[model samples]
Target: MGAAQGDDQDEWSFLFGMLMDDATKRGLAHDELYFLSDELLRFSLAYQGYEPLLEAVADGELSRLRFMHEIWRAMPEHFYVDLALKLGAELLAARQ
Candidate 1:
């Protein structure tokens, strides 16, 4: 269910920017940064929710927010900072 790489980059950039802006203002600690990021991710997933009933129809089919699952699976402890770092690395890797 992943969007195109170009699309994900643009969207992720906006998300990362917004999260960083608030994180900077709050002077959030490591733990708090992740807490805020997780919340933001949750909100994004909630906003994207559309196929609630259809998601579970197939056994192997991905549910909602498949990209999120990808990000989380790549992250350390599912931290937001880690997500950014990993996503950045993935972007860089894509270029090579």
Candidate 2:
């Protein structure tokens, strides 16, 4: 990956880590947290309108909170919830 891409990945990974840590503290399991992070990363990459947000984050024009806010606003609520629940269930099933 190019420098900017690498930096974006690093930044996103850090952001996701924070989210996972928070979720874990909230009583969710690590498997769900990992799946959530992976799905969020994939969504950020595939979402068409996410480029500007990514660029802003990479350029330091946006705080991590702002970037996450934009993502939350951009993604449909039902879709996000469905994705989380589906992935969480899949991971739980695999572990059993």
Candidate 3:
């Protein structure tokens, strides 16, 4: 689902950097930042090469949340909701 092998590493790194920048700018806590960063990296990996998908996500298009839900569903069975909840909290705090 990700980019061709090695190319994925760069994409992941870029996504992490984006999340870190966003989290820092939003004054998010360390744990929240890490959780959001990881989730965002997963999204980036899942949407590799789909510039339209990335743009839709960045612009918060209506489907963005659905896309995230799909990514979460498609992720490994071991993935948990705790991280998502934490990120939600951070987002709520940021909006307040």
Error of 2 at 50 (Å): 2.0
Candidate 2 colliding pairs: none
Error of 1 at 9 (Å): 1.0
Best by lDDT: 2
lDDT per model vs. reference: 0.46, 0.58, 0.49
List runs of model 2 lying over 4 Å from the truth.
Answer: 1-42, 75-96
TM-score: which is higher, 1 or 2?
2
Give the per-residue lDDT digits (tens) of candidate 3, residues 12-91: 44555565567668887433545444366455546443345446656756243333333433333223365687889999
lDDT of 2 by residue, 1-96 (tens): 346553254455566567756766888654444443444534664652466676775686854444554564444445567899999999999999
* Candidate 1, 1-96: lDDT as tens digits: 245433243455455455655656787632346343445455544544333322442242532234333333322333556678999999999999
Sort by lDDT, best first: 2, 3, 1
Q: What TM-score goes with each of the models?
A: 0.28, 0.31, 0.30
Alpha-carbon runs more than 4 Å astray in model 3 = 1-7, 33-96
TM-score of 2: 0.31
